[model samples]
Target: MTHATAPSPDAPLEASATIDGAEWWRSAVIYQIYPRSFADANGDGMGDLAGITSRLDALKQLGIDAIWLSPFFASPQKDAGYDVSDYCAVDPLFGTLEDFDTMADAAHARGIRVIVDLVPNNSSDQHEWFQEALAAAPGSPERARYIFRDGRGEHGEEAPNNWDSVFGGPAWTRTANADGSPDQWYLHLFDSSQPDFDWSNADVRRMFRDVLRFWLDRGVDGFRVDVAHGLVKADGLPDFTPPVGAGSMGGQAADEEPVTAPYWGQEGVHEIYREWNQVLAEYDGQRVLCAEAWVDPLEKMALWVRSDEMQQAFNFPYLETPWNGPALRTIIDKSLAAFSSVGAPSTWVLSNHDVVRHASRLALTAENPQGHGIGPETGDRPDRELGLRRARAASALMLALPGGAYIYQGEELGLPEAIDLPDEARQDPTWFRTSGERYGRDGCRVPIPWEADAPAYGFSETGASWLPQPEDWGPYARASQRGDADSTLELYSRALWLRSTHQLGLGAIEWHDAGDDSILWFSNGPITVVANTGVTDAVVPTPLRDATRILASSPHDEGALPADTTAWFLTP
Candidate 1:
């Protein structure tokens, strides 16, 4: 059921009234919502479609053009909602099909477009097709829909290849016959519960096309293709050797590692996107397909966003770069040039459901690598104040860039990762698969805080949350930050308003020579952004020193830009 809320006095009446038509996505500011942690409407300790509907007003107030929801499709929740059992049905835990329609309607009424997560790389083992494949004979047509092959060793006891699951262990799992005798082995690039689909099968191709249409007909604006480069695999399923610095079996978390294995970024995947693009064209021209591909080399990554393929691919290199001015500038220039080659707009993102929040990450030195998670046992604790300062400055710089941007939920509140999550509460598959050698991603997935004093920080009605929120998050709650002029929330709100009014997304950047290695400056239309990543304060460039006006600044420095600060100025 839908649980609509009364609009706040400060909320915008229409979400995209200011957005340019047909090319809105070219420079739109999209917000990503991790459904289970966004809001809980039924007091079930889990967020549902109704909860998302009730919060549309808040999102409108935040000035986002659209919302990209993580998967809420029918699933066993083994690897969260990524392992889908049914593509066309909503998971009961997240509400019904009617609830999704209601939510979509509410968002549209506010002018906010909706984009859903699409996991086409694999399906849950419990899916009927996979079940059928398991029950059928070795060479039966039912088994052809999935990748099932004979084991290599005697008695069919060995795995087909040396590939490892991204979660851990062998990529292939053995199945048994009715009499408990070993039969064929199946390939699973992720967890054993997710069986890979055989794109070689015409049935698989047709099925996914129908899935895209199913959601498009129901009003979803587009899809954020998960693992967009993983649908195709190398022929003959050859053995893989881990590259230098690559984790064991060449399998590592997609967020931190560049996907370079034989199973990822194969040439055939572009053909899949070409076909999907044709499907999206049948709907609204404004509808988009974004790729979550972590492919390396900015040039190679650009292929996913070619004119005939996806509209945008996440800029992982930009996001993964360290908090240094020169490093960031190099990445920005390369990203812009790479996407320009394909005539597609680059997309920038700092945090997401898969990695640590930038608020904490910015404080850690490059010597201390960020692993799957951080907990009580973590040796290198983040310097909270420094992290938040750099995080806020980073946000200012990212927003001023000339392209589309994504804001992960809670980023506006300057919320840091829940670094102290108890080990018993860890739920990410990475943790269990590695036998707790890594803490996993549970820390960053904690629920957002709405009210400071309310139960579960006002995320749920019954004082319950799927992941425990940290006690110190009270001051960071939306209720506390909403009206504070100096708060991170206000900074984002004002920046976005300026971005829309000035058409900054569609603007082109003009680089400025800051004279200092630690200083970076660029002009986009009437706005000039200056960022200083050095330890000492730096003088504003000659042109910007006498600028017509100051639009915004992270630390609100005077006379000169402070260390680790980013400022936007208006030039005549």
Candidate 2:
């Protein structure tokens, strides 16, 4: 609760000597709670700030050092709170600003820090800034808050830039004049409702810094800057070249028109992040700034966390990599190398509000219909037990890594994807725009099941949830797993305890690729972790000979990891 006095601009900023301290995030476990779906305390079928505040003890019991709440800022919900209408106000649906203050005070009182998501690139059309920009009054300051242009003729028929929106479609949207003629074009890196701000403008930068200060003043710990890399773009808006093959580098098929090259990761982004970090450094301990950057190149990712920039940038490569042992090992090794090269602390995220759940991704295939079996020939079906084992395994591996680890809500419960949404029930904008090529994130966004027979699985009491709760999720609810000694919840608790009590997953990481598809091996000081991504059993070779049994496979055997199991050990 102690606030560091603001340092004078003439004084040197004291960079954190080490990631260790009251900045619990350094060696902490962050549980990401999508406020809308975490718990609906009002019984209105929507999760609110009060609901989250009520769950503080549960989170504390889970042993998470902090809770990264997805945006609850005032918005039209066009992008599910990502498009802010007012950075200083809380949305009515979530609760009032006073409610947020109550939540923050409660969380801090319980030794839990609260971090909220801040999407700087855009705001709702309802935002005062966007409204003023649209009006474009003479010499108005609001006009400078966003990127506004005269017309497409000044650039071209298409967007001045070849950048594609992350939500599918053009990054530029055409606006018409009062007379109905083409008047201007605005840049939107995600949705048209979320316009990109002109970071080049000093006023825009200052305004955003004030926004940050506003939240910090409200007693919130920090922010997770959404789409942090897309803040800046190629000024020229040059044409982009597509990859040679049909799919993206992440192994997903490309749907848009072929281009010569992508337009992300421009050099100007570094200065923008540096300035943000400088402003954030003015806060006290645990006042962190983390970036949600999706850039693949290690150098680009490093730019967001290069000491003078962000405290942490998400390591997304690990999220998309195949769950095979060798693939995971390569990712961990490469990530450590990259973070070390940049002299910044690393961060690992298994899942978030934006992506598919890890359990559903690793389990629930065509051959393995019920996700609980263990066999090389189980093929591809929903293997519940296997999924649970793998969930534990992924947690163990993540905790054993050298950096901070993020856990999406319900991941610890080994929750699977909701498979029964009718077409009309789908609400994800991505699925609507992409013609269902991608399954909507509704599966992961569904209501959190809290009990076996409680109405709507304890998410709400009166109405049905915005998204249907998965049938039979009762077994995975918190009430069901809380007392079970061998449940996935217990495993996660043990993993977190190990990380905090022994610092096994803290400090530096050294990785060794065992050159096998079935196993991923890495060491942090004396602690080592190995995960089996394949269905077949993998043997730990002599290179791992120094390992002593610290934690082993649970509800399954050691040598054979049952598709997605993980194990850990310590060396003398």
Candidate 3:
């Protein structure tokens, strides 16, 4: 934890040479924890705060600077805690507020910062404000906090607009009156149980500001703003159609310009972040705010990370880029330029709770589209060996880049998506909302395997897991990989250790002329990183041929790197 002080924003990027800084997030590796799937402590088939507290040491040992926990806020268990009922309270299923304090204290004691998920775009319909709005008449103050409008039909039978939910249905859900008659229709861009907030309303903005203070007072380091770009609706909330094949949950083609949907990435959201930035500035330790803004075109995404706004934004363009070398190079260049333009650091993420794990993603063909989950009925199964190889290589390449990065839970163990879970065991709303058209994200959210031979893979004391785990995951268990030098877990540990010790994340990139389009070779200070994405083994770039290889994603020939392999070397 001992390192130099942070440099000023205008100072040279190379001067920020260590993880220790008021701006610690700039080059830190943050691990994402999907609570219910991380570990279950209560024997109730659910992961709780105490479970997370008990696991902090493992994360500390993994070399992550912080941990980003998905929503554990009070909710009706709809949308897996994303549909929040109370912003300031912890859900009983997870733990009490005291439990949260204990977890936060535990993490802080381990020198790990905590970033909680903040779902501001919407709230559970059961939330007090939403319920009050439901009981109050239309146009009342309670209703004003949310988007409530009269329907197009005479009896308010029709929805307010033709918008479809991101979860795959109409965005507007109509309500019934006390007399069982049709009432006002409310907007919910996600599930019917979660109603969108009206940022245009002063009270709504004030409430969120207070919520931010609540956590800040409780010593939480930051928030991962959920749907960060969707807080404000387009003026007039006009009817609009999303461009065909448009995706907002990341994994879109890096070159495509995402059409600004009426409900997403409006200019007003900037004002919201600006206000939030002021609130964060009031605290010490450079408390950060990372936006989950899936907005398109790296330029647009950069706006969310301006000096007066958020500190970091997820580099979805980089994550979405294919495994092709030229494409990755283009994205890395574009992302660095974009974030630098705003004086903000970019965040590289390979997988998360909302998408398929990168291991499976890298192995799949174009037939398995991004954002869609796979199941037993899938026609084209991912090539497990190829997927993991590419995934490990991707991790090495990402770690060598000059910015912050995120490692989703179990990713260090090289876990692939459990694509064959029973239909009845599924819990993601996207599954039922799409009526089996899409398998949903449940495949990637399976419980982690802590011990190879324990019941439920050591997820819970009662051998119960919220989601069913694949029986064949023993080889991928963390315990099985802990001592193996070749295991993905150890690979990540060594890479992270090397990354921190070498300050690779703080170094400016200098691309090497590889002469081959499929080879990516770059120097970050004293470290050289090379990846071979070609179909055949490739000779190491001549410029770095004499450099000693320090770490490699796979076993390879003496002078050549295998396809889908990445290696790090000391710059000589």
Best candidate per lDDT, number?
A: 3
How does model 2 fare in lDDT? 0.71
Clashes of 3: 0
Off by over 4 Å in 2: 1-23, 137-142, 150-163, 244-263, 364-386, 510-517, 539-550, 557-563
Off by over 4 Å in 1: 1-22, 247-259, 366-371, 548-553
TM-score of 1: 0.94
> lDDT at 230 for candidate 2?
67
* TM per candidate: 0.94, 0.86, 0.95
lDDT of 2 by residue, 1-572 (tens): 11112222223222223443434555667889899998887888889999898888877777788899999999999878988999989998899999999999999988788898998867887888788788774335676777765444545455565656666667788776577766567877677888888788887788888998999888887889886766675766666644533222122222333332333555777788777777777877657888887665555588777878777778877776656666777777788788778876678887777655777666645321111122223344456666566667777788877677899999888787666666677777666666665544666788787787899888887746988776788888888887675677766766666566556535776667767767676777767777777767666656555445556546444333445667666665
Better of 1 and 2 by TM-score: 1
Candidate 3 regions exceeding 4 Å error are 1-22, 248-256, 367-370
Q: Which tens-of-lDDT digit does each residue in 268-313 have in candidate 3?
A: 9999999999998899877899999888888999999999999999
- Name every residue pair that clashes in candidate 1: 15-110
Alpha-carbon error at 94 in model 2, in Å? 0.3
